[model samples]
Target: MTKPPPTTRPVITPSRVVAGVCLVLPFVAMLWVGSYARVTPALLGIPFFYWYQMAWVIVSAGLTSTAYLLVRREERARKGDGR
Candidate 1:
C-alpha cells in the first residue's frame, strides 16, 4: 500500500523569527571563540574573554525575555486574548 501524504505545516512568521534569533544569539556569541579570546578589552580588570561571556549572560536574558513576550503575544492573539 502507498503511504499517506504529509499534512500542511505552519508557516513561519515574524514573531517566531524574532524568537529564534533571540535564542540563537547567545549560542553564537559564546561559540565564536576567536572573537572574544583575548585580554585587550577589560571590564573592571576582568579579561575580555570572561567579561564578554558575562555580558552575554545579561544580554541573553533580555533577548530571551523579548522573544518570550513577542511569541506569547502572538499566541495570545491567536487564542483571541490579546488584552
Candidate 2:
C-alpha cells in the first residue's frame, strides 16, 4: 500500500511575522510594569500609570485589527483568492 502524503504546514512569511509582533507587543508593554510605574507624567490630571494603560487599550485594538488583516491577507494569498 502507498503511504499518504504529508500534511502541509503553514508558511511563516514576513507578513505573518509582523502580525505576530503586533499581537505580542501589547502584552509585552502591559506586563513590563516598571516602564510606566510612575505618577508624574499626568495626562489631563490622570496619572501616568493609569493613562498609559488606557492609551494602550486603543493602541491594542488597532494593533490587533492590523494583525488580523495581515493574517487574513496572507491566508487569502496562500489560497490564491486575491480579494
Q: Which candidate number has the best lDDT?
A: 2
Candidate 1 lDDT: 0.89
Error of 1 at 14 (Å): 0.6
* RMSD (Å) of each candidate, 1 decimal: 4.7, 2.6
What candidate 2 gets wrong by more than 4 Å, as runs, is 1-5, 81-83
Q: Report the lDDT of model 2 for residue 11.
A: 74
Candidate 1 per-residue lDDT over residues 7-81, each given as its tens digit: 867858999998999999999989989999999778889988888888899999999999999998888887795
Model 2 per-residue lDDT at 43: 91
TM-score of 2: 0.88
Residue-level lDDT tens digits of model 2 in 1-83: 99998887777899999999999999999999999999978999999999999999999999999999999988888779632
